[model samples]
Target: MAYWLMKSEPYEYSWSQLVADGRNVWTGVRNYQAANNLRAMQVGDRAFFYHSNEGREIVGVMEIAKTAYPDPTDETARFVAVEVTPLMAAVTPVTLAAVKADPRLVDFSLVRQSRLSVAPVRDGEWAMLCEMAGISA
Candidate 1:
């Protein structure tokens, strides 16, 4: 299965919110590239739940529960969304600073495209981050 990373501002929709809700459609992506990433996702794909802005850290893991569908927020139907279920919370949130400092993660999408909200994650990178968070990859 493909691995990915999805970012949400803590104040807007945190990892805790996702855990509480169990599952929900991940929507509101306007960027073409991020939209493409969403469309590329499939049910059962795993993703890192990242808290952007001030919290710049990966707090949990999520698995895609539903494949891409027309986004409800887009009247033009230009975007797509996929439902995700919380898989597990990290023992210690993996911070962005830590990610940037790691040589093994220099090629990571999170570092290369810092502004992208959704991006692909290589298996090696995923394993490294999970290791940093003290969780089994």
Candidate 2:
């Protein structure tokens, strides 16, 4: 399955919130690139739940429960969103500082496109990150 990373500000929607809600509609993306990434996602795909802005760390795993669809919250109707369900929390959070310090992830999209809210994760990078986060790859 494809892998991806989805970021949410902890104050707005933390990992705890996702866990509490059980499922979430991932919407409100304004960036064309991030929007496209959401559109590319499919049901069953795994994603890293990242707490951006504040913690800047990946704290959990999630599964895409629904494929891309028009975001109802978007009046312009140009963007898309997916439904996600919490999978499991990372045994250990993978901090942004740690990612930056890892030579293997130097070329990772998270490093290259720090502004992206939704980004694709390569196979090798996903495996390494899962390892770092203490999750099964």
Candidate 3:
């Protein structure tokens, strides 16, 4: 399965909130590239729940419960969204600093395209990140 990293602002939608909600539509992606990434997602694919802006860390894991669909939050219908559910919280939150320092993750999309809200994660990078987060890949 393909892997991904999806960012969410803590104030807007925190990892704790996702756990509490159980599952929710991942929406509000206005960037074409990010929307395309969302469209690429498939049901059962796993994503790292990166808490951007505030925490700047990957706090948990989530599974794509539903594939891409028309985003109800969008007025023009140009964007799409997927449904994600909490899989498990990281035992050790992986910070941006930690990620940047890791030589193995030098080419990771999260490092290369820092502003991208949704980004693809390579298989090797995914495994390394899971290791850093103290979780099984």
Please give the RMSD to the true structure for each candidate, in Å.
0.7, 0.6, 0.5
Worst 10 residues of 1 by lDDT: 128-137
* Clash count list over all predictions: 0, 0, 0
Ranking by lDDT: 3, 2, 1
Q: Give residue 122's lDDT in candidate 1 (0 to 100).
A: 97
Mark the regions of model 3 whose C-alpha exceeds 4 Å error after superposition. none
The digit string of per-residue lDDT tens for model 3 on 5-114 reads 99999999999999999999999999999999999999999999999999899999999999999999999999999999999999999999999999989999999999
Those runs of model 1 whose alpha carbons end farther than 4 Å from true positions after fitting are: none
Per-residue lDDT of candidate 2, residues 69-101 (tens digit): 999999999999899999999999999999999
Give the winner by lDDT: 1 or 3. 3
lDDT of each: 0.94, 0.96, 0.96
- For candidate 1, lDDT tens digit of each residue in 1-137? 99999999889899999999999989898899999999999889999999999799999999999999999999998899899999999999999999999999999999999999999999999899999888888
lDDT for predicted candidate 1 compared with the true structure: 0.94
Better of 2 and 3 by lDDT: 3
Superposition error at 14 for model 3 (Å): 0.5
